[model samples]
Target: MDRKEMECRLHERFSWLDSLDEQNSVLGLVFCKSGWYNLICEMLTEIEQVYNSKNLQLKSIDLYEIKEKYGTMQTDVGNCIPEVYEIVERYEAKSEGVCEVCGAEGSLHDIDEWLMVRCEKCFHERKRRFYKRGLIT
Candidate 1:
């Protein structure tokens, strides 16, 4: 999904995202896909709620592929917290079998020899959209 759709979903789930922005707790938050963004925020929200850390801040949350076989989530909370990495690992494991482009049951597919776990339906949808936008030739 696009920015508006992502923001709409985020706002629906956790209204604090906007407030966090105003409080300067969220920085450099951009370009994250909708599902991944939700997963990351869900983790952080749990941390914030459990620790009750009023001073909590997020430095960054980045997702990238590793060797075309796995995906990684790099998150930096302002302060050290226990079990946070473990929680991140759980989410990573969950993402592995899921489509990166859409939250569907998907395994890796080779597109131009690049591996991506996207369902056949979304694969076609994304391909069509890209072609229509002249992003593909």
Candidate 2:
């Protein structure tokens, strides 16, 4: 079948998984289409080239386990994985803040100096003093 038809069929068959907002579900549909089949195959082969270029760690897990847990065998296996953006936000929050430039704690400052968000205490001290000097160039 054509890509559009394939996508339509996949979507119709897997509407419930679509409700879960799973990336793999979308990827699976894209991967299975005649039009996207070659593209996604290449994309998967060179996934690192598109994102996470360095230190690529391509791996696969058992779909049967996922099917057993979620009762569907589509790409998402029931859309259980968290969104990438959410995971990144959680990581940032847990990591606290260190200076991106100098690795100083609490020294990171915004351009306007109005917000003193989570930085290390030493970094904040420097930023506060620097703000007073008008030398935060």
Candidate 3:
């Protein structure tokens, strides 16, 4: 599914884990490429399982931000146990090998000073576009 669909699904399934005021803001959204959709879903599902097992209350946990940065997934959450953070970190590390453009095996690359994880095909395509745009040689 696309980002919008993924976001909606997350909200529908795990809305209680999110903060109240920020629910409609950009910070509340999952900000990442379509490639990481499955990874994100898996992470959240595990988190939900843990949350339910622990009997956490609605709105007690705050999933502040979910985004990609420095070629890795970054999830910012609040009012939770360390295990939650650990789960997020594990998926974040896994994202390093998954393409940000296409869900394929990939590695980190420096393109026009931007760090991103991309497979060979997506990497070369991005490079070609960058060169054409005078962003890179």
Best by lDDT: 3
lDDT of each residue in 87-129, candidate 1, tens digit only: 6567666655666666677665655455566778877877787
lDDT of 2 by residue, 4-44 (tens): 55555544543322322444443323322142232223322
Better of 2 and 3 by lDDT: 3
Better of 1 and 2 by TM-score: 1
Candidate 2 clash pair list: 105-120, 105-123, 106-119, 106-120, 106-123, 106-124, 107-123, 107-124
* Reference-based TM-score of each model: 0.53, 0.24, 0.85
Best candidate (score: TM-score): 3
How close to the true structure is residue 96 of candidate 2, measured as C-alpha lDDT? 31
lDDT of 1: 0.53
Q: In order, what lDDT does every prediction score? A: 0.53, 0.34, 0.82
Number of clashing residue pairs in every model? 0, 8, 0
Q: Give the lDDT of residue 16 in candidate 2.
A: 28
- Give per-model CA RMSD: 6.3, 16.9, 2.5
Ten contiguous residues minimizing lDDT sum, candidate 1: 59-68
lDDT of 3: 0.82
> Which runs of model 3 end up more than 4 angstroms from their true locations?
17-27
Ranking by TM-score: 3, 1, 2
**Backbone clash pairs in model 3 (N, Cα, C under 3 Å; residues 3+ apart or in different chains), count:** 0
Worst 10 residues of 2 by lDDT: 64-73
Candidate 1's TM-score? 0.53
